[model samples]
Target: MDDDEVILSTPEEISAMAEAVKENLLPTKSRRLYEKSYEKFMSWRSEYKTTSFSENVLLAYFNSLIGTLKPSSMWVEYSKLKSMLNIHHRTDISQYAKLIAFLKRKSEGYKAKKAHTFSPDDLQKFIDNAPDYTYLLSKVAVILGIMGACRRQELHMLKIDHILDADNTLVVNIMNTKNRIDRTFTITGKYYKLVKKYMNLRPNTCTSQNFFVRYISGKCVAQNIGINAFGQMGKTMAAYLNLPNPELYTGHCFRRTSATLLVDAGGNIMDLKRHGGWKSTAVAEGYVDNSIQNKKKVSNLLMNSIEKTQPHNATTTYIPETELVPVIPAPESHQKNITPTLLPSETEPTQTPLLSQIQQDSDIPINTAASRNGNITPTPLPSDTETAQTPSLSQIIQQNSDIRINTAASRNGQTITISHNTIHNLHLHFHK
Candidate 1:
């Protein structure tokens, strides 16, 4: 009813409103991060009086950050800002190839530092040495985190109702995973009993529905475990086991530890992917590549193969007995026994005819696989032409090449040979 208020009912206005909503296109969890990233760029742009964005601006911005931040952080900020800029300003910077190359050039020799993982022996020490009354919560968290390959958020979001007890095992369901893929894992043996003990200790008057609860002194408390507390379970176990660099053991150490242990136990990359709920083969193979047991196994296998090596057998081919009837050698100019049934070679003219271009002669009998099963019905040379001049052995094969020219005496041992460049239609049936 108020005429002063603007009405946005036109198609163009509606489209503008649609584009305006894209400012929140980033993931719900990372919107705050995107905002912070975008704010940094906006502040820089304001200081330099750069009103518009371009590949040049992004390149300069990253170049300025080169000395101030770690190479990895520069990339992180680039990605966050790229996504935010696309959504808020409708600028697509992903097609900036040169800018990407510059980032890659700057990132040379920059290796990411991985989180430290404790071994099964270390975990065993924690289980046996740490008192159950004081570290029951830590025990349960560590076991579930490592066994299930759980992220910190997954553990934090786990509710009491998600756990199912079926006879001897306790089945735990993971619903809110990073990939949105649901996973179910079960605890058995002592792990199952340990989880059951913790479940019994959970306060009946607890207000939270989360499976993990805060424990003080010797008893469980009413408060639920925070994400940071879930993450600290790694440090707690590491410190208890007297492992070095306890501070480097973070929430992801459990996931990495699970993959490494499985690979050490003879599991393949596929097994790592399936057990850890990883979708990328590269991510799964990284664990295998870093495993010491796998490396030792591969080295031993290579050395064993070398030690067991034997001399290779001479190469031979199965020549149809009917074809290439062993040409017996004579003390004369050529072999006395001439197998006219064999395809005769033409006279050595001034030019060597390209054998590849030569078509099958009607006079030549089919001396291939088809002839092998039956008798060879060789056609005689044209009556007008005298006995065709036989091509020398060197002409048929290369100089110094291995040649086992079998004669009537060696017919039992078939030999195969070929010429260089092209073998023509001489599809000689060969076998070892």
Candidate 2:
């Protein structure tokens, strides 16, 4: 239907509709909510006051909302609009329920888009190529996000005094956070130079303790710049870098990036949750989800563990001069025997799977009966078995348990004290 075809019912159609709704019995909050909703409704569909805004209109508006904001924001806005119809316009209870149901469906669709923040490398690129003079602010925002793992609003609320260096370590105290909870994050040595640089370059040196201040009038400092300022800065930097969507790199991107970087740097989800000030691990999980670097590291570690756990005679492709193997092939006989078991694997398990290998050489144990103790003792050298002067179990054990060492001179021109510690060190070296 053409928007022009809709007839205006009154001179002030929107206000008339709101006033009519106000006449109905409702609470102050309900009346206020009605007024706000009616105003917003009129802003979108001016004819909604006179003509019935059909379901098509609702769907159209919801569709238009796609990509305009986050799913959660869209849902909140939609809920507000729907609620206004019920509370202010006195929409029938049945119709109100139906409208909310429809909006819930729309919200799910919005959520299906899968919100994502910028990656570390991309964020770095944006910072590196960002406009001159803006580099300090752009990177500092990201650093604060990482160090404090705080949301944009909390970081924006930070004051100059937020950084306390009593113990020679810098820290950022996050106030006015999402959950209304306060927390502090330690600024470690890795970010020492960056924090110092930001402190030196930070604008608006105020007598008050606001960490982030802006310059407004002459030489005066403005207290607590808005979170939108950081977002604007991100957008401007994105534009200067010729990014696809400049608005996507808002201050929250820094927070998400911080969590992601920590995950890459061997930090755990619990640590991320604490640092990011998240009520639950869900948000932190999103920040680090599907991380290719971390996944590859985990895959490599699992593969290494599989190799370490394999039978010693497993025809392993070991690194030269070490017992560790890059790749190991199971014995042909074992593979043949296991064919039946492998045949049933039409569906692979979604979780991590263990790798199995069979011994291919005679130097290792195969049967469980022969695999006694955690220790594997190398047999006396046969003519065929080329043996290097390997360390002994006691020496290896001593080295693992104690620092005490006793050297024994070799009588056969090459005698060496092979301790348990030497073996442990060798194992650690090979694992690395």
Candidate 3:
């Protein structure tokens, strides 16, 4: 087969060579599963008495499973079938655009079940209450899983020798990982004590090199814990802590819990991504979005914005539930026969009605604060001025349109004083 030396002897091609090619194409771990998926397709062909294998045949086969399987499950089935057929049937299901669209359309509105992430308080409860001797292995695994944010496979492949003792602290090195990248973390303080105690208790008779061991009763019995056992660590801890639906806490819970707690504590998402070895920013920030503290922080921010009162100055005041003011200046003196022309514009409006004007248009005498060419100004009250106990008419004017107010009475009187207190943007004048 090497060097292409010759195409001699009629160039023989073996029928059984297809099986060898299929085996080589499949992943070693999932080889059995790949074979099973292909065998299922073969069985269906036999049952239907249709030996033909084409896009149409696959379409019909998949259509038969539409109502029977969830879209997500069908996707898994598609992956397995695609892998096997790519080698044997020479069909690249990935190139089937129509089939991809069909599955995508079918998956619309499908809300996937999310794994539960436990709170740090619940984790603390388990750590404090769970007996160390009875759960020595689990105790170490759960803490390491969360603190280091280790995946289940990473935990499974962890070796006893991989944990190095450095200046009274234990440094855990994950030699084997799902991403094939090495990650190291330190276990110090009380956490170091737990690991140290477990290490001291390891049976010398064990041959396996894995760090976590199979424990029965209160002691470690073997080395190299199974992957499934590593995965069940979350579920086991959840059940022991009396959490509802312990099964919902999958193996990824420790990883999620680690990211969530870090996010809730105001840790940077980029740092969390590096901490958990997540390459995707969306994945890292999703933990932040789900954090109870993060959501609470957003809620408070929105509320404070809506409920905001006034400015930063000491004199600034807020509107009450009912309209009110802190102070209202009292009128200086009461007067009569004084048609107060609100503004100093020499001539009053003939169309608008004053007290005298309403009855009949008459020449009304006004005050002498300002001449026809000058500006009008009202005196502002001091801080000691008494405030209104209830809402003032100024509030009604504030809510309603600005209107000119005029009054006249037929009697000898004094100058009528206008108070600028409690009223915003209001000025009135009198002519003598």
For TM-score, the strongest prediction is 1
Q: Least lDDT summed over 10 consecutive residues: which range in candidate 2?
A: 350-359
Residue range 1-432, candidate 1, lDDT tens digits = 112123634466666676567754778887788889899899999999998789999888888997898888888888898888776676788888988999889899988777787677888888778999889888888888888888889989999889999998999999978888788899999989988999998888997889888887778989877799877888888888778889889888887887788888877777778887889998677654365676888999999998567443424333344443222123222234423233333332111222211111111111233223224332222223223245433223222232222233212222222233223222231111
- Model 3 per-residue lDDT tens digits across residues 1-432: 312224443343643464466578777776888788789889998999997767778888888888889999899889999877877656788887778888899899998776688787888888778998677788888889888988888888788789899988988887656655677888888888888888887899988888878877767786567889877888988889888999998887888788888878878878897887778898677654366777889999999997675444434333343332222321333222334343333342222222222122222233333322233443322223334344433233333323322222221332332222212232221110
lDDT tens digits, residues 1-432, model 2? Answer: 222224643356666665666456444435566566568666778644545666666666667766776667766666566556665444543354555675567566443333245666676676556443446555666667766766767766787666787565786677766676788877766455655665665554356566666533222344556778876665665566676876666666666667778888888878877877677767568776467887899899999998678663454443333333222332343233221222112232211111112122211221222212325432222133222255532234344433322222111122122223434544453355
**Global CA lDDT of candidate 2, please?**
0.54
Which pairs of residues collide in model 3?
Answer: 327-387, 337-409, 366-431, 366-432, 367-430, 367-431, 367-432
Query: For candidate 3, what is the lDDT?
Result: 0.66
Best by lDDT: 1
Q: Which runs in model 2 stand beyond 4 Å of their true positions?
A: 1-35, 38-74, 81-101, 107-134, 200-209, 214-226, 235-247, 297-432
Candidate 3, poorest ten consecutive residues by summed lDDT: 423-432
The estimated TM-scores of all candidates read 0.67, 0.50, 0.64
**Cα-based lDDT at residue 226, candidate 2:** 73
